[model samples]
Target: MVAMPEPSAPLSLRHRLAQNLRRLRLERQWSQEDLAERSGLHHNQISMIERARSSVGIDIVEKLMAALGVRASDLLD
Candidate 1:
Protein backbone atom coordinates (compact mmCIF):
# COMPACT_ATOMS: atom_id res chain seq x y z
CA MET A 1 0.00 0.00 0.00
CA VAL A 2 1.23 3.46 -0.89
CA ALA A 3 0.67 6.41 1.35
CA MET A 4 -0.02 9.91 0.12
CA PRO A 5 2.14 12.78 1.27
CA GLU A 6 0.60 15.47 3.46
CA PRO A 7 -0.10 18.80 1.78
CA SER A 8 2.58 21.36 2.32
CA ALA A 9 1.87 24.88 3.51
CA PRO A 10 0.80 27.29 0.79
CA LEU A 11 3.53 29.49 -0.65
CA SER A 12 3.67 33.08 0.56
CA LEU A 13 3.04 34.35 -2.93
CA ARG A 14 -0.12 32.30 -3.24
CA HIS A 15 -1.36 33.42 0.16
CA ARG A 16 -0.56 37.06 -0.55
CA LEU A 17 -2.17 37.03 -3.96
CA ALA A 18 -5.31 35.25 -2.79
CA GLN A 19 -5.66 37.51 0.24
CA ASN A 20 -5.15 40.66 -1.83
CA LEU A 21 -7.67 39.54 -4.45
CA ARG A 22 -10.27 38.78 -1.84
CA ARG A 23 -9.64 42.08 -0.12
CA LEU A 24 -9.93 44.00 -3.38
CA ARG A 25 -13.17 42.28 -4.34
CA LEU A 26 -14.62 42.92 -0.92
CA GLU A 27 -13.63 46.57 -1.06
CA ARG A 28 -15.58 46.91 -4.30
CA GLN A 29 -18.41 44.78 -2.94
CA TRP A 30 -18.14 42.46 -5.91
CA SER A 31 -18.91 38.78 -5.95
CA GLN A 32 -16.84 36.13 -7.68
CA GLU A 33 -19.39 36.12 -10.50
CA ASP A 34 -19.00 39.87 -10.87
CA LEU A 35 -15.23 39.63 -11.14
CA ALA A 36 -15.60 36.75 -13.58
CA GLU A 37 -17.89 38.75 -15.83
CA ARG A 38 -15.58 41.75 -15.77
CA SER A 39 -12.50 39.65 -16.44
CA GLY A 40 -14.18 37.42 -19.06
CA LEU A 41 -13.29 34.41 -16.95
CA HIS A 42 -15.54 31.72 -15.48
CA HIS A 43 -16.91 32.14 -11.98
CA ASN A 44 -15.54 28.80 -10.87
CA GLN A 45 -12.17 29.74 -12.28
CA ILE A 46 -12.17 32.91 -10.22
CA SER A 47 -13.19 30.86 -7.22
CA MET A 48 -10.34 28.45 -7.83
CA ILE A 49 -7.81 31.24 -8.18
CA GLU A 50 -9.05 32.94 -5.04
CA ARG A 51 -8.80 29.66 -3.17
CA ALA A 52 -5.33 29.03 -4.62
CA ARG A 53 -6.56 25.78 -6.17
CA SER A 54 -5.52 27.23 -9.56
CA SER A 55 -2.09 28.61 -10.22
CA VAL A 56 -2.14 32.28 -11.17
CA GLY A 57 0.06 33.09 -14.09
CA ILE A 58 1.10 36.53 -15.28
CA ASP A 59 -1.54 36.58 -17.99
CA ILE A 60 -4.31 35.86 -15.53
CA VAL A 61 -2.80 38.37 -13.14
CA GLU A 62 -2.96 41.02 -15.83
CA LYS A 63 -6.58 40.19 -16.47
CA LEU A 64 -7.33 40.42 -12.78
CA MET A 65 -5.50 43.75 -12.53
CA ALA A 66 -7.63 45.17 -15.29
CA ALA A 67 -10.82 43.77 -13.82
CA LEU A 68 -10.05 45.04 -10.36
CA GLY A 69 -8.39 48.32 -11.33
CA VAL A 70 -5.28 47.35 -9.41
CA ARG A 71 -1.61 47.10 -10.27
CA ALA A 72 0.06 43.68 -10.16
CA SER A 73 2.11 45.01 -7.24
CA ASP A 74 -1.11 45.40 -5.32
CA LEU A 75 -1.62 41.67 -5.40
CA LEU A 76 1.93 41.12 -4.28
CA ASP A 77 1.19 43.16 -1.19
Candidate 2:
Protein backbone atom coordinates (compact mmCIF):
# COMPACT_ATOMS: atom_id res chain seq x y z
CA MET A 1 0.00 0.00 0.00
CA VAL A 2 1.15 3.51 -0.77
CA ALA A 3 1.63 5.77 2.23
CA MET A 4 0.01 9.18 2.31
CA PRO A 5 2.37 12.14 2.10
CA GLU A 6 2.42 14.63 4.96
CA PRO A 7 1.29 18.18 4.34
CA SER A 8 4.01 20.76 3.83
CA ALA A 9 2.25 23.09 6.25
CA PRO A 10 0.32 22.40 9.40
CA LEU A 11 -3.40 23.09 9.62
CA SER A 12 -4.05 26.72 10.59
CA LEU A 13 -6.16 26.03 13.66
CA ARG A 14 -3.85 23.40 15.05
CA HIS A 15 -0.84 25.61 14.55
CA ARG A 16 -2.48 28.52 16.29
CA LEU A 17 -3.72 26.27 19.06
CA ALA A 18 -0.23 24.90 19.56
CA GLN A 19 1.22 28.39 19.73
CA ASN A 20 -1.33 29.48 22.28
CA LEU A 21 -0.73 26.45 24.43
CA ARG A 22 3.00 26.98 24.43
CA ARG A 23 2.68 30.68 25.16
CA LEU A 24 0.31 30.03 28.02
CA ARG A 25 2.52 27.34 29.45
CA LEU A 26 5.54 29.57 29.27
CA GLU A 27 3.77 32.62 30.66
CA ARG A 28 3.35 30.74 33.92
CA GLN A 29 6.73 29.02 33.80
CA TRP A 30 4.95 25.71 34.02
CA SER A 31 6.72 22.78 32.45
CA GLN A 32 4.95 19.97 30.67
CA GLU A 33 5.16 17.98 33.88
CA ASP A 34 3.34 20.72 35.83
CA LEU A 35 0.64 20.93 33.21
CA ALA A 36 0.34 17.17 33.20
CA GLU A 37 -0.29 17.16 36.93
CA ARG A 38 -2.71 20.11 36.89
CA SER A 39 -4.63 18.94 33.85
CA GLY A 40 -4.70 15.32 34.84
CA LEU A 41 -3.21 14.51 31.44
CA HIS A 42 -0.01 12.76 30.56
CA HIS A 43 3.10 14.86 30.02
CA ASN A 44 3.47 13.33 26.55
CA GLN A 45 -0.06 14.35 25.70
CA ILE A 46 0.61 17.95 26.78
CA SER A 47 3.79 17.92 24.75
CA MET A 48 1.94 16.55 21.73
CA ILE A 49 -0.71 19.26 22.02
CA GLU A 50 1.88 22.01 22.36
CA ARG A 51 3.80 20.61 19.43
CA ALA A 52 0.69 20.32 17.24
CA ARG A 53 1.31 16.62 16.83
CA SER A 54 -2.11 15.55 18.09
CA SER A 55 -5.70 16.76 17.81
CA VAL A 56 -7.24 17.68 21.15
CA GLY A 57 -10.69 16.76 22.41
CA ILE A 58 -13.08 19.11 24.24
CA ASP A 59 -12.54 17.45 27.59
CA ILE A 60 -8.79 17.59 27.28
CA VAL A 61 -8.90 21.16 26.08
CA GLU A 62 -11.10 22.10 29.02
CA LYS A 63 -8.67 20.48 31.39
CA LEU A 64 -5.78 22.37 29.85
CA MET A 65 -7.62 25.67 29.98
CA ALA A 66 -8.47 25.14 33.61
CA ALA A 67 -4.89 24.32 34.38
CA LEU A 68 -3.63 27.33 32.48
CA GLY A 69 -6.25 29.66 33.94
CA VAL A 70 -7.41 30.48 30.44
CA ARG A 71 -10.67 30.20 28.60
CA ALA A 72 -11.38 28.21 25.45
CA SER A 73 -11.76 31.43 23.52
CA ASP A 74 -8.40 32.64 24.80
CA LEU A 75 -6.75 29.46 23.66
CA LEU A 76 -8.47 29.58 20.27
CA ASP A 77 -7.71 33.21 19.75
Candidate 3:
Protein backbone atom coordinates (compact mmCIF):
# COMPACT_ATOMS: atom_id res chain seq x y z
CA MET A 1 0.00 0.00 0.00
CA VAL A 2 1.04 3.58 -0.52
CA ALA A 3 1.98 5.53 2.55
CA MET A 4 -0.19 8.42 3.64
CA PRO A 5 1.02 11.91 4.32
CA GLU A 6 1.60 12.86 7.92
CA PRO A 7 -1.23 14.55 9.85
CA SER A 8 0.97 17.58 10.39
CA ALA A 9 1.44 18.06 6.67
CA PRO A 10 -1.24 16.78 4.37
CA LEU A 11 -1.09 16.95 0.60
CA SER A 12 -4.02 18.33 -1.30
CA LEU A 13 -5.80 16.02 -3.72
CA ARG A 14 -4.67 18.08 -6.68
CA HIS A 15 -1.04 17.86 -5.59
CA ARG A 16 -1.31 14.14 -5.10
CA LEU A 17 -2.85 13.75 -8.49
CA ALA A 18 -0.08 15.75 -10.09
CA GLN A 19 2.63 13.73 -8.40
CA ASN A 20 1.02 10.44 -9.27
CA LEU A 21 0.47 11.46 -12.87
CA ARG A 22 4.06 12.55 -13.30
CA ARG A 23 5.36 9.43 -11.62
CA LEU A 24 3.36 7.11 -13.81
CA ARG A 25 4.28 8.98 -16.93
CA LEU A 26 7.94 8.84 -16.06
CA GLU A 27 7.69 5.15 -15.26
CA ARG A 28 6.52 4.57 -18.79
CA GLN A 29 9.37 6.77 -20.09
CA TRP A 30 6.80 8.96 -21.71
CA SER A 31 7.27 12.65 -22.25
CA GLN A 32 4.44 15.11 -21.73
CA GLU A 33 3.98 15.32 -25.46
CA ASP A 34 3.82 11.54 -25.70
CA LEU A 35 1.20 11.34 -23.01
CA ALA A 36 -0.68 14.22 -24.56
CA GLU A 37 -0.79 12.47 -27.91
CA ARG A 38 -1.98 9.20 -26.38
CA SER A 39 -4.51 10.94 -24.15
CA GLY A 40 -5.72 13.30 -26.89
CA LEU A 41 -4.87 16.28 -24.72
CA HIS A 42 -2.61 19.17 -25.55
CA HIS A 43 0.95 19.06 -24.28
CA ASN A 44 0.29 22.32 -22.49
CA GLN A 45 -2.64 20.73 -20.75
CA ILE A 46 -0.47 17.84 -19.64
CA SER A 47 2.10 20.31 -18.33
CA MET A 48 -0.58 22.22 -16.47
CA ILE A 49 -1.91 19.01 -14.95
CA GLU A 50 1.57 17.81 -13.95
CA ARG A 51 2.15 21.16 -12.35
CA ALA A 52 -1.23 21.12 -10.62
CA ARG A 53 -2.20 24.33 -12.37
CA SER A 54 -5.46 23.08 -13.86
CA SER A 55 -8.65 21.74 -12.38
CA VAL A 56 -9.25 18.37 -14.03
CA GLY A 57 -12.65 16.86 -14.74
CA ILE A 58 -13.76 13.24 -14.74
CA ASP A 59 -13.70 13.09 -18.52
CA ILE A 60 -10.12 14.30 -18.60
CA VAL A 61 -9.25 11.86 -15.85
CA GLU A 62 -10.77 9.01 -17.81
CA LYS A 63 -8.79 9.95 -20.87
CA LEU A 64 -5.59 10.07 -18.91
CA MET A 65 -6.31 6.76 -17.21
CA ALA A 66 -6.96 5.11 -20.52
CA ALA A 67 -3.79 6.50 -22.06
CA LEU A 68 -1.73 5.44 -19.10
CA GLY A 69 -3.26 1.97 -18.97
CA VAL A 70 -4.08 2.44 -15.31
CA ARG A 71 -7.27 2.22 -13.28
CA ALA A 72 -8.83 5.23 -11.56
CA SER A 73 -7.85 3.79 -8.20
CA ASP A 74 -4.23 3.59 -9.35
CA LEU A 75 -4.25 7.28 -10.02
CA LEU A 76 -6.34 8.26 -7.03
CA ASP A 77 -4.77 6.03 -4.42
The candidate maximizing lDDT is 3
Residue lDDT tens for model 1, 1-77: 22223458544677678778989999999999999999988999888777766787899999999999989999877
Order of candidate numbers by TM-score, starting with the best:
3, 2, 1
Candidate 2 wrongly placed segments (more than 4 Å)? 1-11
Model 3 regions lying over 4 Å from their true place: 1-8
Summarize candidate 3's per-residue lDDT along 1-77 as a digit string, tens digits.
24456778977787778889999999999999999999999999999888878889999999999999999877777
lDDT, candidates in the order shown: 0.84, 0.83, 0.90
Per-residue lDDT of 1-77 in model 2, one digit per residue for the tens?
A: 22223577544777678889999898999899998999999999988888778898889889988998889988887
Q: Candidate 3 clashing pairs?
A: none
Q: How far out, in Å, is residue 25 in model 2?
A: 0.5
Q: Whose TM-score is greatest here?
A: 3
Predict model 1's lDDT versus the native. Answer: 0.84
**Model 3, global lDDT:** 0.90
TM-scores, one per candidate: 0.82, 0.82, 0.87
